[model samples]
Target chain A: MINPQGLMIVLSGPSGVGKGTVRKAIFDHPDTEFEYSISMTTRNMREGEVDGVDYFFKSKKEFEQLIADDKFIEYAQYVDNYYGTPVDYCIETINDGRDIFLEIEVEGAKQVREKFPNALFIFLAPPTLGHLEDRLIGRGTESDDIIKNRIETAKKELEMMSLYDYVVINDEVDAARQTIQSIVTAEHHNRKRIEQQLRKHLLEVD
Target chain B: MINPQGLMIVLSGPSGVGKGTVRKAIFDHPDTEFEYSISMTTRNMREGEVDGVDYFFKSKKEFEQLIADDKFIEYAQYVDNYYGTPVDYCIETINDGRDIFLEIEVEGAKQVREKFPNALFIFLAPPTLGHLEDRLIGRGTESDDIIKNRIETAKKELEMMSLYDYVVINDEVDAARQTIQSIVTAEHHNRKRIEQQLRKHLLEVD
Candidate 1:
C-alpha cells in the first residue's frame, strides 16, 4: 500500500490551556502514528529533565550559531532563552511518513506557517476566556501580577485563533484529544493525497 | 452552550461504489447528528418504498412545476425521470443546526457546489479501478455490456475525484464509516466557527 505522505501539524495555545495534557493523551494512544518534534532551547536544564527528551538543551553561543546558520524553522527568545524547532528534523520526520507535532506559541506558529503553509495548524483554546483566566489564577504558585500578565497574553493568543485551521476547546481533556486525533485521521484521507494513489490505480487499469 | 452550525456535506461516487452503504453506517451511529436529505424523484414508487422516506415521489407534472418554480437546489433528468433536492428543505435543515448529507452523482454534486461552495465535498472510491471493476462484476445481476458501460462511467467519475475535498477508499466498510465520522467531528471544531464562539467568550470577560 502506498500510504499518503504524513501531515505536518503545528499546535499552538496560550499558557495554562492544557495543550500539554491533551497532546500527552493523544501520543499515549498506541495507535497514534505521530512523531513529537523535539525543540532546541538555550535554557539551563531543570532537575530531572533529560537532555534530548525534555529539550535539546544548548548553550547560548551554540543556539546563536544555529540561528546564524538559519537552522531553526522558527525561533523566539523567551525570558532570555532562545527556543526553536530544528528545521531539518521536522522535515525529515514528516518525509518519513509520520505526522510531526510542533507545539509552540502563536508567534512561533506564525513564523512556521510562512515556511510550511500547507501544514495543519491547530489552536488549543479554553472553553471560555473566563475559564482561561480562572485556570491561570487557579495556580497558586504564580503571583497576582504574573497571573494578570498571563491572562492578558492569553487574550492576545485567543485573538490569533482565527488563523488556525482547527481549534480544539480544552473543555474536557479526553474530548479535546479525540478531536485532535480525528483531525489527523481525516486529513490522511484528503483528496490531495488520494489523488496520487488514484492516478496509480488508473495506470494499472490502462 | 452554543452548538456549531451544521455542515453541508456532499458524498459523490460512481455506481457500485458503495456510497450508500458507507452513508448508512455513518448515520446508524447513535451519536451521529445528521439529517439525510430526502431527494425528490419523478420515478414510480416501487413496492416497499414509502413516499418521503425512500424518496419523495412526484408526478411528472409536479416535478416539472417544481423545476419551473426553481424549487430544486440541484436537479437532473436521469433515465427519463427527474430527480432533485428541494432547495428549502436542505437550507432549513442545515440552518437548524443539523448536518445534512447529500448523496448524489458527480454532476449533481458539482451543481450543488455552485450554491454551497464551502460545503465539504467527499468522493468515495473503491480501493482501485481494478477493485471497482471486480465489485461491479461481482453483483452478477447486470449483463456484461451494462457492466462494461458502468465501468466506463465509473472511470469518468473517478476523474472528478480531484474536484472533491476528501476521497475515502471504500476498502473496508467500518473503517470508511469511521473516517467519515471523523471528518464531521473535526469540521465542527474548525477555527472559522470557533472564532465566533471565542469572540462571545471574550465579550463576557469584558
Candidate 2:
C-alpha cells in the first residue's frame, strides 16, 4: 500500500499557557517521531541561538519579500518582529509521509486553519483561569496592571479553545505531552483518513 | 466540572478477524478501565461458562419478551438461538461516567450506530484478505466450500469499513489492543465532547 500523506499538527493556546514547555517535553521524548517545523523570524538572533537551528533568521526586507511571495502558511508580527511558518517545508514533509509539528500563537493558528482545515489543532489550555493568573504573577517582572491585562487576554484566547480538535490541559508538562502523542496515534487510525487505502487493498483482491 | 458522559465503544469486524482475541487482550491489560457489557443469549450455557459471567443466559421466551419490550440495543438470531446486548446496562454505565464496551457483529454495530450515533465505532480488520482466508482455513473444521463462503462474507463485511470511526488492523493482538486504548484516550480529549465545561470554567471566571 502507498503511504498516506502525513498529519499537520498545530499546538496553539493562549500566551503563558506553557505551550513552549509542553512542546519541549514532547521533542525531548525519544518516542516523538514527527519533525518540528522551524519557524522564520525577522527578529535579531539572540546569542546562543543558531540562525537555522533555532530559527530561519531573516531581515525585515527579506521577511516582507517572502510574505509578498505568499510563502508562509501563517505569520504574525509581535513587538515589531515578524514570525512565520514557511509553507514549502510543511508541504514537503507531509508529502513525504512524515508529520510536521508547528507551535504557533492563536492568530497564526487561525491562519493555518484557513489554509489546512484538516490539520490537527490541539489547544494547550491552563488548568484554570486562576491558575493562569498565578502563572502570570509568578513571572514577577510584570507589574499588577500588566498581569491583569494578560489575564484578560488569556480569557479571550481561551474562548478560542472551541476551534481546536483536542484540548490538553497543561497541568503537568509530561501528561500533556503524552496526551498529544496519543492524539497523533489515534489520528493515524481514523477511518476517514485510512479508508481509501484499506478499501482498495481489500476489495481489489477479491 | 462535572464528569463527562462516558463513551459507548463498539468493537466489530468481519468474522474470524480475531475480535475476541483482541478484546481479551484489552480487558486483560491492567490499564483497561471500561466495563464490558455482558451479552444476553439463549444459546445453551456450557459446563464451565457461568451465568452472568460468560453471558447473561436467558430462556428463548425471556429473550423474545425482552426484545418485544425494547430492552435490547441490538439482537440477532443464529441457528435458532437469540443473542443480544441489553440497552439498560450500557445506558446506566455511560450515565455513571464510565465507558461501556460492546463486542458485536457488524450488523449489530450498524444498529447501534443508528441508536447512538456518537458512539466510538472501531472496526477490527485482518492484515489482508489472504490472511483472513488463511485464518478461516486454519479453523480446520470448515470444509473448502465453507471456507470460501466465509471469505466472501468477509469481503462484504470489509466493505462496511467506511461506516466505522476507527479501523484497527489486527496484525498483532498487543498492537491492536494498544491502538484501541490510545483511541479511547484521544477521544476523551476531543474538543467537541469537552468544550462546554472548559468554556464555562474559563469564561465564567472573568
Candidate 3:
C-alpha cells in the first residue's frame, strides 16, 4: 500500500478576526502536530525578527524568479513587496506524512484552494459583525478613516466565509483553537478521505 | 432568526462489530449530551427488561397500526416480532435543539438515511476482515454454519460502509468513543451547517 499523505490545513478569515492570535494559540498548544509553513517575503526583515523562523527573507530578484518558476502556491504584491507561500515545502511536508499548517490571507487561501483543492479551509469568524467592528475600532493605532476602511474590507471578507469548510468563531481564543484541532481530527476519520486505504487493507484480507 | 436544529447522529455497523458496546460507553460517559432514541418493539419483555427504558413495548396490533400510520422511522420484523425506531421522538428532540443518537443495524440506518438525508452516519468498522472473522469464531456458542452465515452478512454490510459520512475503526472502545466525540464537536462548527444563522446575524448587524 502507498503511504498516506498528510492534510493541508489553511486557516484564514477576515482581517481583525484574530486569525493570527487564534493561530498562535493553536501552535502554542502542546498537542499541535502540524508543521507550520513559514511564508516567504521580499520585504525587509524588521528588528528582532528571525531570518527563517518569523519569515523567509528573500531578495526582490529571488522572489520574482520563484514566481516565474511557479514555486509558490500563492503570491501577492503589496506596496512593491512580494509575499507568498512556497509550494515545495508544503508538498514535501505533506508527502512525508506530516500535516502542514498555513495561516494566510483570504486571497492567498483562494490561491491555495486552486492548487490544493482537497486542503482543509477553516475561516476564523467573529462572534458577530458588530464584534468585528469593535475589535477594528479598539485598536487605537489606526485613525477613524483607516478603521472605517478596515471595517469595509472585513465585511467583504466575511462574505467569503462560504468558501471555508469550517468556521471557528473567535469569541474566545482557546475555544477556537480547540475547534480547529477537533476539525483536523475528525477530517482524518472522514470516509471520503480514508476509504481508499481501508479498501486496500480489506482486499488484502480477502 | 429561527432556532437552530440539533444534529441526528446514526451509529451503524455490521453485526457483532460492538455497536451496542460503543453506544453504551458513549451514553455512560458524563459528557454525552445526545438524547438516546429508545427503540419500540413488539417482542416480549424479558425478565429484567423494563418498558420505556429497555424498549417501548407495544402490542402486535399497535405495532401494525404504527407501521400503517408511518409512525416509525424504520422497522423490521424478526421471528414474528416487530422492532423499530419511532419518528416523533427524534424530530421532537432535534426541534428542541438537542441532538438525538440512534444505534441500529445497517438496514435500519439505511432507512433512516432515506428520511434524514443530512444526518451524520458513522460506520463502525472492524480493524480488519481477519479480526472480524476471529471475533465471529471466538463467540464459540454459534455453530459453524451460523458463524459462516454471519461472516457473509458482515462482508455485505461492510460494503455498505461507503454510504456513511465517517468510518471509525473499532480498534479500542475508548479510542473510538473519543474520535466520535470529536467528530460531533467538529461537525457543530461545520460552515455549511451554521452559515445560515451567522448570515442572519451579519445581515442584522449591517
Best candidate, DockQ-wise?
A: 2
Off by over 4 Å in 3: A1-3, A42-51, A57-62, A78-82, A203-206, B1-3, B41-62, B77-82, B139-141
Error of 3 at B63 (Å): 3.7
Worst 10 residues of 3 chain A by lDDT: A197-206
Model 2 alpha-carbon miss at residue A81, Å: 3.6
Best by TM-score: 2
Q: Residue by residue across B1-206, what tens digits does model 1's lDDT show?
A: 55546789888888788886787787788877789998888877756668987689999999999899999889987546787888887898888888899887777888998988879898888777778788878867667988888888888888888889888889899998889989888878777755786667654763
What is the DockQ for all candidates, taken in turn?
0.57, 0.62, 0.61
Any runs in candidate 2 off by more than 4 Å, and if so which? A42-61, A140-146, A204-206, B43-51, B57-59, B78-81, B141-145, B204-206
C-alpha positional error of residue A160 in candidate 3 after TM-score superposition, expressed in Å: 1.2
Q: Which is the winner by TM-score between candidate 1 and candidate 2?
A: 2
Sorted into a CAPRI-style docking class, model 1 comes out as medium
What overall lDDT, based on C-alpha atoms, would model 1 receive against the true structure? 0.81
CAPRI-style quality class for the chain A–B interface of candidate 2: medium
Who is ahead in TM-score, 1 or 3?
3
Interface RMSD of each: 2.4, 2.4, 2.2
